[model samples]
Target chain A: MSVLLSATRISKRFGGVQALSDVEFSIRRGEIYGLIGPNGAGKTTLFNVLTSVYAADDGRFEFDGAPLSGLKPHQVAARGIARTFQNIRLFANLTAIENVMIGRHVRTRAGVFGAMLRTRATRAEEAAIEARAAALLDYVGLAARADDLARQLPYGEQRRLEIARALATEPLLLALDEPAAGMNATETSDLRRLIERIRGDGITVLLIEHDMKLVMGLSDRVLVLDYGRRIAEGPPAQVRTDPKVIEAYLGTGATSATRAHAEPAPAGARPGAVPGAAN
Target chain B: MNRAARPRSPLAALGVILVAAALLVLPFALAQAGTAWVRITNLAILFALLALGLNIVVGFAGLLDLGYIAFYGVGAYVWAMLASPHFNLHLPFWAILPIGALAACVFGVLLGAPTLKLRGDYLAIVTLGFGEIVRIFLNNLSRPVNITNGPQGIARIDPVRIGEFDFSTTSKIAGLTFSGPIKYYYLLLVFLVVVIVLNMRLQDSRIGRAWEAIREDEIAARAMGIDTTSVKLLAFAMGASFGGIAGGMFASMQSFISPESFVLVESVMVLAMVVLGGMGNIWGVVLGAVLLTFVPEILRYTVEPLQKAAFGRTIVEPEVIRMLLFGLALVLMMLFRPSGILPSSARRREREGRQP
Candidate 1:
C-alpha cells in the first residue's frame, strides 16, 4: 500500500508542559492504523497537530507526499483530511442531512450570485451535493434519519451521524477519535465491520481507540505511546506481548490513578473481560 | 420518516397574496382617510424596508451592528448631493439611487473588511463608533461649502425621474399626472415588495446557510472550508445596500436631508423592529417595523384628545406617552420573548430541544 500520511518526529508544547515529543506516526493507504495510549498521553494532541487545530512546535506532516505546513484546519480539510471530534461537535440546530451537506462546502462551487439567481449550474451542483450527502448518510446507516435535527438523535446514532458528516467531505484519510466508544458489544462489532468496509473503499483510517479488542483485532499495525512519547510499535501480536506495552498500560500514571481510587479487578483480569474469557 | 420531513407551509404563499393585496389597496384606503395618514403609511413602509435590511446583519448573521443607520444616512446624503438644488447638480433619482446603493456597499466593505474578525460586543462598539464618526464628518463638512450644507442641511431635493416621466407634480405619465402621497406610496410599496422577495430568496440560499453556520458555531463553520470573513462581509454589504436604497427613497419623498435624521435612536428603532418581529425572519421584521412606526401616530390622535377632555388640563402629552409606552413595550417583550415573536424555525427547534 502507498503511504497516505506520515508524521515525522512531531513535538508540541503548551507553555512549559510538553504535550507530544518526538512522536513518529504514519498510515498507509487503505490501512487501519490504531493509536493507543492512556489518557493525557498526547493522542489527541497529535490529532490536533495533524489537523492543524494546534500547530506543532517541531517536526512536519505530509499527506499524499505533499508537505503540510502553516495550513489552517479548513485548509487541511480542503486538502482531503477529515476528522470527527472525540466529543461530538455538530451544529445542533441543523438537520442531520444538512450537517453532512455542510461538509460538502469545499466541493460545491456555487457562489452568492449563482445561488441568488438559481443558475442551472448551481442547481445541478446543489442536487449533486445532496445526493452525495445522502449516500454518505446511508453508508453510516443514517439515511432514515437524514432530515431529523442532529441533537434529537439517540447517542449512538449521533456518533454515527458525525462519521457520516465527515465522510461527506470525501476524504482520502479519515481520522476517527473513537468509533467504538460508548457502544455495546453488538454495536462495536457492527462498527468494526463498517470501518473495515470504509477501508475497503481505499481510504486510510487513523483511529484513536481505548477498546483493546478493536485496537488489536482490526488494526493492521498499532502504535503505542506513554507520557507523550512513543513506547512501542508493531502488529497486534508483537505489540501485545511487548513488555513496554504492558508496563505503559498497567504501570502508567493513568492506570495507577484509576486503580488507586477504584476497586481493583483480580490479578490476570484483562480489560475487556467478557463472561467466559478465562477459558 | 423524519419529523422535519414535513413540507414547508403554504403560509409563505398566503403571506405573499395578503401582502400584495394590502400594498395595492392600503394607500387608496388611507387616501380616503386623509392625505397626512397616507403619507405616514409611506414613511412607515420606508422604515420597514430599512429595518429588514438591518435585520440581515444584526438578526441573521448574529452581528450587532450599531452603525447600521450610517448606510441609510449615506444613501440619503448621496441622493441629496447628486440631485438637490443645494448642490445644483440635479441627476435623475433613478440614477442616484443605484449610485447610492453602490456607495453604501463600498462603505460597507470598507467598514466590514477591517472589523469582520472582531466578534460579538467588540463589533457592536466598533460599528457604533463608525456611525458617530460618519455623522460628525457630515455635520462638519462645510469647509467644502458647495457639497454638504452643514447643520443647515440640504433641501429641494428633486423627485425621481424615469425617461421623461418625472415623479414631480408638473410631470405627466400615460395621460395622467403623478402627484402627492399616493404616487410615492405606490412607488415605495413596489420597492418594499422587491426587497422582501429578494430577502426571502436570500434566506434559502447557500450564503444564508453559511451565515447561519457562522452564527451557530464559527469553528465548525470554518472547519467545513467556508471563508467566514468573506461570508460575513457579504451579509453586511448586502444588508447595507438595502438601507441605501431606502435612504435614497426617503430623500426624494421628503425633499430634505439632514445628519440628525440618522442618529443613534434611528439605529435602535430599526433594531427594535427586528427584535419585536423576529431576527432571521424577514416578514416578522417587516411586521415589527409597521406596527412600531404607526402605533405612535394612532396614539397621538387618542391620547391628546382624551387628556384635554378629561382633566381640564393635559394629563400627558401624546408624544411623551407614546415614547414611554414604546420603551416599556420593548423592555417587556425582551423580558418575555428574548427570541422575539416569530423566531426562526431552526432557532425555535434548537431552543425547544434544549429543554430537559
Candidate 2:
C-alpha cells in the first residue's frame, strides 16, 4: 500500500520540556494506524505537529506527495487531514448539522456577494452541504440529534458528532485524539465499529488512543511512544509485547497502566471501566 | 436556516403588513405636527442602518469592535469630499455611495489585517483607539491639507439626488406633500429594508456558518479548514461597508458633517442597540435603534417640560439625565436578557442550555 502521510525526524520543545524528539512514522493509505503511549508520551504533540497546530522545531512532512511543513491548521485541513480534539472542541452553541456544515466550508466556494444574493449556485451548494451533513449525522447514528445543539448531545453522541464533523471535511486521513476517552465498553465497541466502517469506506484513520482494547483489536499497525521518542513500531501483535515498550511503561508504573493496555483486555466486558475514560 | 423549513404564521404575516403600513405612513402623519418628528424618525432609521452594520462585526463574527463608527465617518467624509462643493466635485449619489462603501471596505481590510490576532477586550481597545484616531484626524486635518475643515465641519454639502429629483425639496406626490424629512424617510427606509434582507440571507449562508464557527472555537474552525483570518476580515469588511453606506446617507440627509457626529459615544450607542435589541437579529437591532432614538427624543419633550413646570428654572440638563437612564437601561437589559431582546438562534440555544 502506498503511504499517505510520512513524517521524518520531527522534534518539538516547550521551554525546558522536550515534547517530541526524532519521532517518525508513516501512515499507509486505507489502514487504521494506532498511536499508543502512556501519559506525557508526546502523542498529542505529534498530533498537533501533524495538524500544523504547532510548527515542528525540526521536521519535514509529506502528505499525499506534497510537502506539509510550516502550514497552518487550516492548510493542513485543506490538504485532506481532519482531526478531532482530545477534550472535544466542538462548536458548542451551533446545532449538530451546522457544525458538520462548517466542516464543508473548505470545499464550498461561496463568498459575501454570493451569500448576500444567494445566487443559484450558492443555493445548490448550500442544499448539498445540508444534505451531506444530515447524511453524515445519520452515518454516525445521530440523525435524530441533528437539530440539537452540540453541547446538548450525550457523551457518546458528542463523540459521534465530532467524528461526523470531521468526516464532513472528506478527509484522506481522519486523526482522532482519544476517541474512547469517556466511552463505556459498549460505546467503545460502537466507536470501533464506526472507525472500521470509515476505513471500509476508504478513509485512513490515525487514532491516538489510550483505550487498549479498541486500539489493539482495531489498528492494522501500532506505534509506541515513551519519553518523547518512538520505542517500537510494528503490527499490533508485535508492538504490544515489545520489550522496550514494557520497560518504558515500567519506568512510569507499568503494571497498572500499560499491562491492561499493552496486553489484551480481560475477556469479560468491564462496562464503564474503560481505562482511558479516567482521563 | 430553519426559517424556510417552518411555515410562516398568518398572524405574524398580518402583523408584518400592519407594521409595514405604519412605517410607510407614520412619517406623513408626523409631518402634520411639524417635520421635526419626521426628521427624528429619519434619524432613527439612519441609526438603524448603523446598528445593522455594527451587528455584522460584534454579533455575527463575535468581534468586539468599538471603532465601528470610524467606517461611518469614512463614508461620510468620502461623500462630503466628492459630492460636496467643498471639493468642487459632484459625483451622483448612486456613484458616491458605492465609492464610499468601497473606501470603507478598504479601511476595514486595513484595520482587520493588523488586528487579526486580537480578540475580546484587546480588540475592543484597539478598535476604540482606531475610532478615536479617525475622529482626531477629522478634527485636526485642517492645518496642512485642510481636508476635513477642522472643528467647523463641512457644511452646504449636497443632498441626495436621484434622476433630477432632489430629496431635500418638498414635492407633491399623489395627494400628499412630501417634505424633506418625509422624502429622506422613504429613502432611508428603502436602504434599511435592503440591508435587513441582505443580513437575513447572509445569516443562513456558508460564510455565515464559518463566521459563527470561528466565534465558537477558532482552532476547531481552523481544523474544519476555515481560514479564520479571511473570514474575520470579511466580517469587518461587510460591517464597515454597511456603516459606510449609512454614513453617506446620513451626511446627505443632514446636508452637513462634523467630527463630533461620529464620536466614541456614538460607537458605544450603536453597540448598545445591537446588544439590547438582539445582536445577531436584524429586526431586533432595528427595534433597539428605534427605541434608543425615540427615547431621548421623548425624554427631551417630557423631562425638561416637567422640570420647568415643577420649578421656576431648568435645574439639570436633560442630556445628563438621558445619559444616566441610558446606562441604567443597558445594565438592566444585560442583567435580565443577556442574550438580547430577540436573541439569535445560537444565543437562544446557549441560554436555553443553561436552564433545566
Q: What is the C-alpha lDDT of each candidate?
A: 0.80, 0.88
Candidate 1: list runs displaced more than 4 Å: A184-187, A252-279, B1-18, B144-146, B168-179, B309-312, B346-356
In the range B111-215, model 1's lDDT, one tens digit per residue, is 899898898889989999988888888888978554677777899998877776566554455775445677888788889988877776566556777777788
Instruction: Please report the candidate that would top DockQ against the real structure.
Output: 2
Candidate 2 residue lDDT tens string, A1-279 = 999999899999999999999999999999999998877889999999999999999988999999998799998999999999999999998888899999999988899899888788888888899899999999999988877889989999899999999999999999999999889989998999999999999999999988777888899999988779998999989987776766554543443555656663322222234434433
Query: What is the per-residue lDDT of model 1 for residues A1-279, given as tens digits with 9 covering 90 to 100?
Result: 788899899999998889899999788888899888767888888988998888899999999889988998888888988888888778887778778888888767777678767678877777787788889989989888877788899778888888887787778888998777788888888788888998899888898888878867889999887778999888877776666666565553334334332322212334443213322
Candidate with the greatest TM-score versus the true structure: 2
Q: Lowest lDDT 10-mer window, candidate 2 chain B?
A: B347-356
**For candidate 1, what is the DockQ-based docking class?**
acceptable
The residue-level lDDT of candidate 2 at B180 comes to 85
B213-300 per-residue lDDT for model 2 (tens digits): 9889999999999999999999999999999999999898888999999999999989989999997887789999999999988888
